[model samples]
Target: MSKVSLKGLLSSRGPSALRSLRGGAASALSDGERLAMLDELEKSGLGWFWASDAEGRLTYISSAIAERLDVPLADLLGQPMTTIFTAAEREGRAKSLSLMLGAHKAFTGMAVRATRRPDGAVLRLAGQPVFGTGGRFAGFRGTGADISEEFHREEETARLARYDSLTGLSNRHRMAHQIDSTLTAFRAAKRNCAVMMLDLDRFKHVNDTLGHAAGDELLKQVAERLTRAIDRECEIGRLGGDEFQVMIPDVDDRGVLGELAAKIIAMLRQPYSLDDGRCVIGASVGIAIAPHDGVTCEEIVRAADLALYAAKNGGRGQYRFFSGELENETIFRRRLEQHLGEALREEQLFLRYEPIVDAAAQTVQAVEAHVCWNHSERGIIDEEEFAQIVEGSSLIGDVGMWAIREACRRAVLWPDSVRIAVNVPVPLFLSENFVGEIEGALTEAGLTPGRLELEISEAVFFGETSIVDRTLANLFKLGVRMTLDEFGSGYSSLAYLRRAPFDSIKIDQKLVAEAERHDSRELGLVRAIVALAGALQMDTIANGIESAPLLAVLSDCGVRYLQGPIFSEPVDQDVLEQEIADGSWKIDPGAERTRRARRRTVFRKIEIFHDDYAYEVTLRNLSRTGALIQGLANVPKGTQFVVDLGGGQLAVATVTRSSGDTQGLEFEQSLVDDGSGGLCTRNRVSPYALASAGTPLAALAPGSYQGMVGGLIDQGGAPKFGYAPGGRGD
Candidate 1:
């Protein structure tokens, strides 16, 4: 043990022993010397040796590992080698240890994690198959070196590449690859995959008001909410900066996709309390289905992106499914936006007024000024279309100020009692000189400030609290009545009502439209809003009152003023002035009768089937559960027929009334909502079902086939009744 003794021992050691220790070449050393060298190597604890039998059972293991693993040598011997070492380990490349041992192949530098060792050592293993002199299958002998630290470092590097550092979700690159791979695999399997593109609404506002740090924190919370909202085996990724994408596999049902999209929108809209302040934002989702919307990654993603753009343009905070019509809409919107800048300069923009009638007095109370754009080519674009074009544009303020001035000027020509109401967008109303602009318009037009009403939306609540409050207070002090527009259309806050001092609330047309339906809850909501308005000393204006029944309901509900198609469509300034000069415009109390179902007039060809024979008839009107058909002569009452609506929609109906060539038929089943302002059959003819029935279908192409056994009839032979080009038969 002394230094002199150790020096003498090393001096006596042969060159062969040193060479064997260095593993240069095999030395002709005695068995005792070889055993001593192996013991010295095991004692060094830098490396370990392992061997397995032909059965993949551990036969030998270094004592150092055995001691480190805290397992007795007898306990480890004859155990499955896979039990001691984890499965496929990843170094530069990954190879399954069990597979390599089973194949008896040579492998090296496989980073394997030790399962038995409590220290969780990652060992770099090198193994070569050993065979007997007879060339029989033998076992594996491998050397392992601990590389846990190195493995973790490499894993961290890989993690950075695949995940978002801020949110810890998949990054853009990873999401794209994931969608591509999933869609590719699902395409071959004839499965469906859906991709949803989400954009956070008002995220930039938060980032601007608070800071990037708060925005980042908000995104983390959004990611968490998304993960919880989906609750499916889908890939959710942050596609950088408030845009996220979700790849859902094996889901093609629009209903399910819509529900998920709604859930995500709702979850993200909840208020987030950051370190600085509380903020709320919404999400818009665009969904595209594989093989239907597109097949390729770019195609599908582009489709979804277009849908997202449409959703955002459609007034934000909603989900839209990709359809062929959306592309045209997007293009039209872009062109309209371009044209909108020139609208005011070219004198194409003008204001029209729809009369607001006092329900009790049955007299004109006010007229809302709606901006109308008469495109040279398109001719009379809807207000909504113009809104979509001007939304979020600087030109909106110009146009808005022009409208205010023009409406004030127009109001000067009207009778003293009739007031003029002009809608003020949140941006325009919150502008620095909004109050000054109102005053300027009034002073220039020589109109009373009280007659000029500024209609503001609840979105003003989302702006700077103090600024919005001050702006509204200043407007109120300017002798202008400030009415809250589109009440209940979004997050209507009680705090906003209590703080800003609004004079009236316009019940959103959506609520009014829904109240006309059979939904009692919507009616109750309308009643509550009216009662709430009354309690706050604010008047309620029922909007979109197209039906006489809705008018009666609102009148009975004590709604003070009304504005809709029922009273009048927006008229030019001349008509509005003439109506005002001709005394008062009173709405007829008994304007129309109430009906159970809403009917839309139509003039299109519809195929009718009776006793295996198809007849071509003109559809004069349509409802959810019935339709009136002309050109079908002598169709007796109670005769059953199948009406072929377009897009594989079929409705079985029985004739309830017949007079000559005109007949009314009642549907066997009610139609479901098409999500747009239309009705469709709940079920459609599936391509797979058609293929299963021996029909050759590449996909569900448009058009109908007459005289085909399984296809819906498009046309029929000469009809029993005389053919009429118009709905009425001679």
Candidate 2:
């Protein structure tokens, strides 16, 4: 309709009609004045007014909109309102526009994008339902305003809130809300969800040495790897700093989660190429499952955090499942950390040397320096435990420098030909004064630089190339040999060999240990590494060679140097000096090769039973095959009994040797290997079994599974052996 026709309609309806149309905002204005104001508002270009008939066809629209839509008013007037304006995708308000129009209900501020506009225009529509005299449904008469700019601005704001600026992954806030919503829904559905908390092991070192730009670049690369490693359905978020979280829905199996965690760790541990830096960082993951581990956000997150702490504590580059035990252990770890600082300050720390011998020459050519803590109150602490206590702490660098200095000092007492191999932590190796520190130690100790070999881990290869190369060159110029330690443990990048100036490769103990387990694939991998090292003109040393068979295998595989318990445990500096004075010491690789099961001389009390009686026997020596039990007086040679190995693990054993209160019992079936290199039973006594036996339980606790043993113990009867009630009388 023309402007003259609109004015005529308002005049025909009088001022009362205009007042109702304006919602009484301009009630004092006359009919002609209101009509002029409405006409001017439509022509102002700020907004447009539209009227649709009962069938949803546009009866009237501002002439400007009709022109903007590239159609004449007559042609546009007959078209369906839905055809002219459609809901923009993902706009919440616009999605329900059609439904609201269909309901003939009054609605306001419904956002919709114009279908005919070329610029992808968004409009906000507000209208009240227009009814006929009979109260019958007519159509909507709404005002539309251009909100395209505001719409995009809101969208960008939302994106910023949800995404990480650096890696473009989800941010922590988004992850928290996502996890909260998912867990809530999953809990109602009685399904499971898992959360993995990961932290980069050496990320801070990258930031400190190469600057935050390289660290940010490294994190971006890490995020990309994480995306590839995790399932597409899983939600990954950068939880600030070097921390990240992954949410996997419909997964509760520890085994599957473990594999996923391993994949993530392996992928992230790969070398990252920054602008001018080659960065490598390892990740530790802690996984928590819903219902089993926790049910709510805080509970699950805390569980995962605890598990992550445990993983880092158990030495980085590993994953751990959340368990109740970690709660108590975390407190102990804090105490250990505090004590470690004191130990370093009080000079209670000492060094032990494990000889790295040439398998072919049968001579000790070098010794790897291991730091040990002689805690005044806690006795001797092993390297693994101490490493866990000091990892990610400032004390590590102090201890590392001390180890390097002490090793150099001690090397002066050894033969000039004997080299001292001291481990260089990634943090220490990337430090600004690493080369200076090495030179200072060598100068102070009066030791030649060549005699002080530096053992650098594969991790050090993942930093700024210029710095790492410069550090390596400086050490090389000083005549120090750089051996790449733990070669295959992380990325096993052949790229390191191509670019790095490593003089030798220390084959990771895992590969050697895996070879002993009869894994042909692992054996082939070890051989391949040795062959690769040989091709590169770098010597390969096999570590963790405890078995003679593995030793023979390594020797046959053409490995030159070897280190492990087979030769000797790491000895003190005094003993090391004595060994060096004795000249070359060698391990006899052919020394009585045996496949004997590893036996632990544990003196703990264990339950053994035969027939209807259970005996509290003292475990002397235990192995996968059998156990030596004391306190069983008249046990026959072939007497059969079940031994409770704690944690619901039970083994049926038969007495093979018996003398007085001591008997050697053999297991009916072999025990299965625990993932941690420990042993557990192939089958466990189920909680259902315990319940069926009329003994109900909430959960099985350690040592509480004694009741799970079949048959009743004759507790009222006389003692089985002639020993004190609490004493193991030998």
Best candidate, TM-score? 1
For model 2, how does the per-residue alpha-carbon lDDT over 1-730 read when each residue is reduced to its tens digit?
3432456545654654455467767366666676788888878887577777789888667776666556567766767888877776552434666787898888876877667663576777887787778998877767777777897888778888999989988999999999999999987776778899999988888899789888888888888899999865899999899999999998765556776887888788877778966666788998887756677999999999998888887778888877666778788777777787788788998888888889888789999888888877768877656776777576777789999999988889877778999988888999999889989999999998888878888777666678988888888788888899888875678877877777899988776877775557878888898889888889999887777888888888888999887777788887877766766666565577445676656778776555444567788987788888888565556666667776445677777998877789888876643322235554445434555555433443223234553322333442343332433332
Tens-place lDDT per residue, model 1, 1-730, is 1112212322344453234234557668865675577667767987677767788888667767766656667777788878877743443466777777777788887766657663566777787776765988677766767676787888878888988988899999999999999878876776778899999999999999899999999999999999999988899898898999999988866667876887788688777889988777888888887766777899999999988888787667778877667878788877787877788888899888888989988799899998989999888865655665677566788888989999999888878888999988878877888888899999999999999988998777778787898888888888998899888764566777889788999998877887876467888888999999999999999887777888878888888998777767678877876777776777664555334465666778867665445567888998888889988665667777667775435677778999988999898777654333345554434434445555443433323333332344323432343334433222
Clashing pairs in 1: none
Least lDDT summed over 10 consecutive residues: which range in candidate 1? 1-10
lDDT of 2 at 597: 74
Off by over 4 Å in 1: 1-45, 51-78, 88-94, 110-121, 128-140, 231-233, 325-327, 341-368, 374-376, 406-420, 445-447, 461-469, 485-499, 504-730
For each candidate, the alpha-carbon lDDT, in order, equals: 0.76, 0.76
Residue 361, candidate 2: C-alpha displacement in angstroms: 6.2
Number of residue pairs clashing in candidate 2, backbone atoms closer than 3 angstroms, sequence gap of 3 or more or interchain = 2
